[model samples]
Target: MFTNEQVDRFHKDGFLVVPHFLSQATSQRLLKISHEYLEQIDLSNHPLTRFTTSDKDHLGDEYFLNSSDNISFFFEPDAFADVDGHHKLVKPKERAINKFGHGLHLCDANFAAVTSGNADVSEIAKGLGFQRPRALQSMVLCKQPEIGGAVPPHQDSVFLYTDPLSAIGFWIPLEDATRENGCLSFAPGSHHDHPVTKRFVRRFDKETGEQLDGTEFISLENREQIEKGFAKEENQKWVSVECKAGDLVLIHGSVLHKSEVNSSNKSRFAYAFHLIEDTAVYDKLNWLQSSVKSILY
Candidate 1:
């Protein structure tokens, strides 16, 4: 549970960092499970989907889109090397993946233990004024050594949209996150100024009204208004947030945040999940959808 001062800080700054939120044993257990999942990946029949937010053209494919209720793997853009006319993995498959995500908490028992129905998480959610918090998507982001990609500045609500925008991100570092290893950075209090003006939605065929294969980002505002909003954000200063293993960083859904590319020899691995108020209406057109019953503690 958080103190009154900590809650005030979160409301004022749009983010809060709690040192050693998880025990070393719990952190290591999660990391071990992540490694086990990675080691079992069979890339022979994989489509080799590279996860990137920078490229709009390469956003989501069938493998990525259909991962809402199932565990799935995604590769880093630089994880492959062109061999002859075919693309080959530059490293072992375990080290080459960028992340495996979207449904770990619902499908995996170990992850579900820490994520769903946890006393600590439930307490935190209640303290944050969540009456019925629903755990939605979960992922293990692997910022691989030397090839980790930079995440573009964006808000979480753009992807996991709700009627009143109640999405919150819980990010826990599994290893030491440093400036050299692609730690998260944030524009302090940007959530107050930056409104949710864009949404990442699932496209559909106009003639048949059937859902399309990929996703796209659509503007809630006109072009001129969106341009002006971007201009306003260009002047804001960003502060790097570095943390040790087991540290918890709570991110506001509307906050502008990003991470740089990892240029170091060390890897930065982290577990993250999103929660939304069940009272809010979840948009049907959002890219992620789940049939599994959401965990509510």
Candidate 2:
């Protein structure tokens, strides 16, 4: 639970970095599990889903479906074998995984406890004034050495859409995270101004129950118009949030945040999960929708 001062800071800054949320022993254990999964993942017939904005191409059906409940991997844009071409070539599966996620909490008991038990992320949410927070997704980000990806400035509400835009992420570092190793940087109070612009959604052919192969975006406002507004506010300064093992960073849904590419020799590992208002209407069009029974902690 956070004190009034801490809560005040979060509302003002759009983010809060709480140190030592997990014990050193716990951090080590989770780090070990992260590596074990990396080794265990079979790439034999893996659907290589590399997420990149450089090409501006749409993601495939394999990425959308596999993203829901599996611990699938997505490669960084820089991990490509050839970086010059429009169709950037990917490196071998083992070497290219920028992140592997979506179901770490549901599938792993240790991770479940972090959200629901001793770590009690639920209590923290309630303390910060969430009415009915529900755990939605979990992932381990491998800001891999040298080729770590650069995440563009964006808001979480765009990807995890709810009617009133209630979503927050609990990002924890398993190792040291610094500006050099792609630690998060956030625009102080951007959430208060730019709540949402566009959303990633699932479009269905009403006549058939079959799922579509392509994903679509639903505009919350005229994209260019909203982007212009944000551009005007771009002068707002962002603060780099460097953290250590066991530290937790709470991020508001509408906050503008991004991370740089890891150019260091060592890897930076972090585990992240998000929660949304359970009672709110998670739109039918949300691409990442799941049953309340399945997502709620």
Candidate 3:
């Protein structure tokens, strides 16, 4: 749970960290499940993507491009290998995964246990003043040792947006997260000034009933783009959020945040999911849509 002081801090800082929100046992259980999934993946048949940087290329790969109603595995940019004349997935699955997500909470029982009916997560949501909250995404971001990519500063609403910007990110580190391994960083109270700028959306044609051609980045009225938005004064305000395993970091929807690449020998792993207020209007065109229930699961 959270105290009044913590709640007040969240309102002002646009983020809050809850230490030891999960037990070591629980975190280990989730980590085991993640490893199990990774072990079962067939690298020969796996879509070996070094990194998912291609918005256009993803449209061609069925596994990466298609939005299934089930859990899927997405590989890191360095997951592939150069075999003879071509690059393919290198041996040892532990070194390949970038992240596996989108529907894990709904379909994977192991993952669901922590994301849904999670008392700590629930309490934090309530403390942050959320009403009618619903889980939207469940993912494990693997900041693999050497090749972990840098996540440029951005907002939750940019990816998982709602009309009223009522989404929050619950990031739980499964292992020690430190400055050397790229922990999350934030610009305090950045949400107060910035609004949802761009959205990854899909449009359907009325005549054919077919999903629109490709993903679209619908731009909204905002002063600056994510990469270049912050001024020197604002940039100076950025702070690193280091965490131990079981610590949970709650993030505001419009907060400016990003993580550096993991250049260290140690790997950084984190379990994350997003919750949105049910009262808000979730954009229908967002790329991640649910099948069993409304995408707001």
Q: Pick the candidate with the highest TM-score.
A: 1
Candidate 2, lDDT over the whole model:
0.78
| Regions of candidate 3 where Cα sits further than 4 Å from its true position | 49-62, 65-68, 81-83, 203-210, 221-236, 294-297
Which sequence of candidate numbers ranks them by TM-score, best first? 1, 2, 3
| Candidate 1 local Cα displacement, residue 246, angstroms | 0.6
Which candidate leads the pack in lDDT?
1
Stretch of 10 with least lDDT, candidate 3: 53-62
Report, for every candidate in turn, its global Cα lDDT versus the true structure. 0.88, 0.78, 0.76
Tens-digit per-residue lDDT, 1-297, candidate 2: 567888899999899998888999998899999888877777767665767643256464666455756577777666665557556546655556788878777678888778745436766887777787778888889888888878878888888888887899999999999989899999989987766888876767768856676677677766777666464446768889999999999999989999998988778899999988888898667777554333443
* Tens-digit lDDT track of model 1 for 58-105: 567888988988889999989988999988888888888899888999
Q: After superposition, how far is residue 18 of candidate 2 from its true place, in Å?
A: 0.5
Candidate 2 deviant stretches above 4 angstroms: 53-55, 58-60, 82-94, 205-211, 221-233, 292-297
Model 1 residue 62 CA deviation (Å) reads 1.3
Between candidates 1 and 2, name the one with more favorable lDDT: 1
Candidate 3 pairs with clashing backbones: 50-76, 50-77, 51-77, 81-88
lDDT of 3 by residue, 17-39 (tens): 88988899988888788778878
Least well predicted 10-residue stretch by lDDT in candidate 2: 288-297
Tell how far residue 19 is off in model 3, in angstroms: 0.4
Ranked by lDDT, top first: 1, 2, 3
